[model samples]
Target chain A: MRHYTAEQIAELPSKYRAHFINSCTGFKSANLLGSISEDGITNVAIFSSVTHLGSNPPLLGFILRPTTVDRNTYENLKKTGVFTVNHVNQNFIKEAHKTSAKYDGTVSEFDKTLLNEEYLDDFKAPYVQQSRIKLGCTFENEYFIKENDCHFIIGRIQHIYVDREIQAEDGWLNLERAQTVCIDGLDGYALPQILNRFTYAQPDQPVNSIKDLGS
Target chain B: MRHYTAEQIAELPSKYRAHFINSCTGFKSANLLGSISEDGITNVAIFSSVTHLGSNPPLLGFILRPTTVDRNTYENLKKTGVFTVNHVNQNFIKEAHKTSAKYDGTVSEFDKTLLNEEYLDDFKAPYVQQSRIKLGCTFENEYFIKENDCHFIIGRIQHIYVDREIQAEDGWLNLERAQTVCIDGLDGYALPQILNRFTYAQPDQPVNSIKDLGS
Candidate 1:
């Protein structure tokens, strides 16, 4: 097996950065936006650094690369204590990725991308109407990792919208049918195909049957 | 458009948990095991809630169900501060699911499944040798959401073992080639397929290509 030093890995091209590459395969692309300006809409960006934080309070979180240029999304969410998470599916992957670009303070990506915006009742920020799944989230807490230029933003999910047909009997989402795209590297999208299903069981059982577990 | 009250959504069957459905798709699965006895392993369970938290320090995290049945996995990780995150690919999806079975304290699911155990130099925990991607993680911190029975366990990734072929320029893992499986809901696995590539661009641009971003 070939091995490279950590220094060698770090010296690779920006496009080939390990984080960008390893990050590509697993994370779901999401759009984070909040109303901070007088117009009540100022910052929007696409983030792949998101994951489910918890389920009880229905919490979710995403990490933002700390920026010196402008803290619109972070600042807005902090000020207003509310934001929105919009999922990116096949139809909106390109438009959603566009939200990652650094636009001027006044420019809204919503105007640039083909994504439509719909505001929910009592929530100040608008969510991506075209997204197959969307969640209205209230700011929970923010923790900044000291050594990394990243800020972890936790949000309490107040409301969620899912396409009815996508729901499975056991609370499973048919993302294949949802046509949701998964990210890879810095610039690739993946379409998912279902390969199998089975129930939960212990690995060492002499007569462990996956069929016996709730498949 | 159809709408359901939060109560209606909450009353949806265990098989219909929203986050369980949405978060499980397009992600790898793993069995988290910990020993309760000096001589045997207890609390063998399966989780698809794992994610790569960070790379600089090689952090990984997974969510544990908050249910209070003396989870062996949770208890084991707590006592030892170490556990293996075993990757469940297409071949092992069924076996991996079995790891979630609520087994007696003496049962070792590792012995029950077809997975082979491999030890890392830096960690005492045994990782799944057959997994295309496996990590030996040292417990860092865990956050328990007061409102939910979900516990988020964050671990410092001490060691990562990946098949050499899957590593691309700058550590980009070609998981599509690896034939890794993504979980959707309780019993579904999705094989990922590459769909598109583009460079990063601002939303307002007439044409934004992820391929053109650095060019």
Candidate 2:
């Protein structure tokens, strides 16, 4: 086992430290955030920080790095007040990752990559046609992380589009079946296989797989 | 494709809605947070919201649901000002999931589950010995998510203990090699296999896998 104190981690090469810190957090969500500028330019970028905030209100949040640099997705969403979160599946991992390249504001990632932009139900924002599962969301709020100068942007799920086959009767999504790839670090993409799904846990009772319920 | 509008989602059965909303965000990080109270009562609980905030300060944050119920992990870390984030591996998925059972403050999840707690280097928190990668962190600051009454707790990484063999020369840890599992929904566990690690993206250049670099 290798032990690294805060000083050692801080002193490491900047690029190496970024990789180490990013990967140490564990697997992150892989999604392409689709937005359209008011000028009719569509933008798509990959994000790994999307997190479920509350189910009751169907709220989700993702961390955005400081806006010191030009952020096309942020600017577009701020102007339009809506964006789409599309799952990055195994089939389009390369194209999805390509969206991360620093293209200028004038150029849309959809034009540069193989990802196609599809407008769903006049949602004002475009969705990735290749995504099996996607969400149409409206910007709700943003909180500033003073420690890191990052922004935690919150959005409310306004619409959900998913392939009917991948959803269970109980509403759980089999992401593996959807072929949604997860991010290992900044650049490592991994496909996951479902190992087990357990039932709701309770004290003093054995944890049993939901498979035991024969669902 | 099945489409669910916001109104339709809001009207869903509570359990079904929870599952639907939770899994839609994509894969989440799987970690067990270990903390001890000042009086020496230890607690461990599974968390899926752990996220990388920044690298310069080596910051990480996780969302803690509203403190309406007893939150031992939050309370203990608050008291001791220190805690540990341990990656959940394939071997201990069941044990890690069991920690979600509402174990009271008097009873430690470590005692009830198969997890063994090992104190590392005078840190106030206990690290899960079964976890291949673990970090000791101190409470840095927290922001209240007013929209949902959740707390976004930030922690500064103080100490990192990892298996050297799993890390690459670039300082990225192959989480797949560590057998670290990712959470699909609230209860599903999945093991991931790396498909490819791409190099940094650049405009006008093809996205190439790191394997092409012969690293």
Candidate 3:
């Protein structure tokens, strides 16, 4: 096992450090954050930081790098107050990954990549037509991380669109059937297959799979 | 696509709603948070919200649901001010998942689960010996989410231990090679195979795989 102290990690090259630090956290939730400017320009970027903040209010949060550069997603989200979070699947991994390419404010990634942007139910932001599961969200709040200068953008899930077949009767999503691909580090895309879904954990008895119990 | 509005989602049964909302976000990072109390009792729990907060300061964050229930992980983390984040790999995913079972405070999850605990270099926390990648972290700060009573705990990475074989020259980790798994919803564990690793995207050129460029 190789161990690195804080000092060593800080002294490493910026690019090397970025990759190491990003991957060290483990597998991240991969989502395409789609937003549009008031003037009608759409922007979608690949984000692996999307996290489930709360289930009661259906809140989700993602970390946004500092606005040192012109961040179209942050700008548009703040302006329009809404955005869409779309899951990246195996079928469109390449196209979904392409959105990470930084384009100028005038260019829409949808025009260049294989992804198609569709407006549904008059939502201000566009949703990825290829995504099997997607959420329409409105900005709830933002908090700045004093340690890193990054902003934590929290959004409330307002609308959910999922394929009927992939959803279970108990409301759990079968991501394996949906073919949603997870991200490893910055660029590695991996397909995930569901091993099993266990029931709510109890104290003493061994953990039991919901399927086995129901069967 | 089946669509659910906020109102519709709210009307769902509590357990069903939890599943629907939790799984709707996307894939989550699967990690075992190892923490020890002041009295020398160790605790390990599976966490899906471990997120890369930033690389500059090398910070990570995870959400702890309302402390309504006796959360040993949260209580121990606060008591000791240090913990370890260990990635769950295929070899020990079941062991990692079992840590989520509500064990009594006196009974360490490490003793119950198949995972072996190791105290490396006298670190306040114990590392999962089975985890190929792990981080020794110190409690930095936390923010309470108003929408839900969840607390966002932030920790600064102080030490990192990784198997040298999985570390790439570019500082990226080949998780597929490590047999690391990604979590689907609460109880589903899934292994991810690396499909492709792309280079930094450029607007002009098409997305290129790092292997193709480097090879």
Which number leads on TM-score? 2
In order, what lDDT does every prediction score? 0.60, 0.90, 0.85
By TM-score, how accurate is candidate 1? 0.80
- Per-residue C-alpha lDDT of model 3 across residues A132-206, encoded as one tens digit per residue: 999999999998878877888899999999998898878889887888888888788888877777767666557
Model 2 steric clash pairs: none
TM-score of each model's B chain?
Answer: 0.80, 0.96, 0.94
Clashing pairs in 3: none
Q: Higher lDDT: candidate 1 or 3?
A: 3
lDDT tens digits by residue: candidate 2, B26-145: 999999999988778898889999999888999999998746323888888777899999999999899999988886778888899999999988898999999999999999998999
- DockQ category of candidate 1: acceptable
DockQ of 1: 0.36
B157-201, model 3: which lDDT tens digit per residue?
A: 999999888888889888877788888777788888778888787
Indicate the residue-level lDDT of A22 in model 3: 86
Candidate 1, residues B11-128, lDDT tens digits: the string is 6565455545345323333334433334445344556556655556456566677464336667777778777665557677676676666656676766776666666564566667
Best-fitting candidate, scored by lDDT: 2
**Regions more than 4 Å wrong, model 1:** A1-17, A24-38, A53-56, A66-70, A142-151, A169-171, A200-215, B11-15, B18-45, B65-70, B78-81, B200-215
Count: clashes, candidate 2: 0
